[model samples]
Target: MERSFTVDVFKVVAAQLIVWHHFSAYGPMSEAMTLQWPQLIEWLYRYARLAVQVFLVVGGFLAAQSVMNKPMTHPVIHIFNRYLRLVPIYIFALSLISLVVAILRTDIHADWLPSAPTFSHFLAHALLVHDLFDIEALSSGAWYVAIDFQLFVVLVVLCNRLQPYGVRVLSLGVALLCVASMWWFNRIDELDIWAIYFFAAYGLGVLAAWAKRSAFDAAVFWITVLLAVGALWIEYRTRLSLALITAVWLTIKPKSRVHWTPMKRVVHRLANSAYVLFLTHFGVIVVFSALWNIGHFHDPVTAFALTGFAWGCAVGLGLFLHEKAEIPVHHWLSHQSKLMFLRLTN
Candidate 1:
């Protein structure tokens, strides 16, 4: 498949929004600056939650591309590959968060900042069951990582099962289940751990991809559009609205053809580093806030600049770790996965 510049751009923009959401929603810096620019902070805090929909939609779209026309040779191996890819960086983020939370909790106080991790909390995080077990999120937004994993596994099974039947039957069946989820399961916040709650958005992504394929019937796309509209008609869900819009955009996207050399390179870099940025950004925010407090940078101009600077640092740090830590772990895990898959197949 050709590299999709459109998807790359979306990832970079959405990742930036998520980063901005955290900076403006947490700690002393956001609180201090809220008074200075209430509207800006409010926009970041409120609207930025929609950025998550972008990821879910994109995830579903990509998942379809991977499994739509093919059988998952080893579904368990595929799921394990995703888990290994995320866990190393996630654990790194959690450790940093726990340390930062411990140090900052001494003097700093905010509802946004999490409390110290207990033994069960650490264990739950290590196992990626923090959300399911009601343990506090060590790093902000870390719950999304687990949720993303669960969504992927569910889609893989749904699409890959009954491979002898056909894509239409499998995809349509999955879509019906997803619609049921959107109307019922997702409304219950307590079911956050399970993929059923988020399957509607994720399924829209899968169906959109099927609709986008040149060889497939265009009706698939229309079906996806209707499901999204129906979800909104049943209930006014802001997240669902964002996911529907994003899924539509992904469905109707042009091929990845970059005309400008410089812009292409920058987009490529940011898109590749988006996941790393998401995992590592909260630590930078905490440290930045702690520094600002200790240094007593209370002036409006300086405080605003501090927030912006920390934002840049967070992206930079993620890029650095992507190269230094995540890439190595990803490559190693992928290699191990292939070998494992081969052994299983043989």
Candidate 2:
């Protein structure tokens, strides 16, 4: 089946928001704007984090849909292909960070990368099992990748028994379970143990996939969208719970299209770079901040401008890496995995 252009646009938008979230974390804007724009900027930061939830939902939906539609006979090969798809870019990003640390000789601590990545650490990261044993994030963004892997495993097990209607039921069940889990964890203060409540976001994605494949109803879709907007507003007014509910509903609804000439094309291209940009953009930001002493940008406007410039550089670097490194590596690893699977089976 052809990819959904609408979902593709949504994914790109979500990815940009993810970058914005990270920029807020690493940039001086948040600290600088605290006094002058406390409520507005802080609210923006919260909303930006919500964008990652959207990405997770889309990923789950697309992944479940792909597996359900194409039903892989060789599950091992499928698993291997998935791992291979992510590892090259991950390793490249890790290497880039290592180079940064070496060049700058900065004493700043990184939770993801150890003082020195030993053989075991390398193996653990390469195998994508770093998070299972409580390994810290080497890069601030790696937590999502670990969560994606875990979600994939969960989907694979569920997909084995999923039928047409089964998908819908399972998706809804997972979403509820996630909300319950989050509530329980929060009550106990164990929320930090799970590393950002990824399972919930992933469940929403699965729900989205089921919604898409089920009968398309215009009223149902609009209702879900309205509820999502309302939920987001409620989240802004009260707490974070409503946002998740609305996100689940939105995932299952088709997004409305807005016609724009050049901006749409630009968004599409940036969306393609979402993964690469997410992985590599941090290195760009770190380098720029170090060189410019961006921490000194005490004014919100100046800090925001510097953050934007840093983001642009990161996007440019990501684009270059996507064309030169990411795409080629993905092709090579995919082809190599196929060849190995054929050899092993034949």
Best by lDDT: 1
Clashing pairs in 2: 57-205, 112-137, 112-138, 113-138
TM-score of each: 0.93, 0.76
Tens digit of per-residue lDDT, candidate 1, span 1-346: 5567878888999999999998887878887888889999999999986898888888887777877666686788778877887788888878887888788775565677887778888778767788887777888868898898888888777756755577667766777777888888978988868889888788888877777554443476566578768768988899988888887887777655667689888888889899999988888888887887788777766878988899889989988988898899889878887887789879
Query: What local lDDT does model 1 show for residue 89?
Result: 85
lDDT tens digits by residue: candidate 2, 1-346: 3456666677777777777777666634555656676775676677776776667766766676667555544566666667777778988887787577556435333332234556676666767767666765556677677667666766665555443445455545454554544444323434433533455455555555555555642233334444444544543322234335544555545555556568777776777778888888777656755554424446667766777788788888778888789899899878887787779889
Query: What are the per-model numbers of colliding residue pairs?
Result: 0, 4
TM-score of 2: 0.76
What is residue 20's positional error in candidate 2, in angstroms? 2.5
The residue ranges of model 2 lying beyond 4 angstroms of the native Cα positions read 27-41, 105-116, 161-197, 215-262, 294-301
All-Cα superposition RMSD per candidate: 2.0, 5.0
58, model 1: CA deviation in Å?
0.7
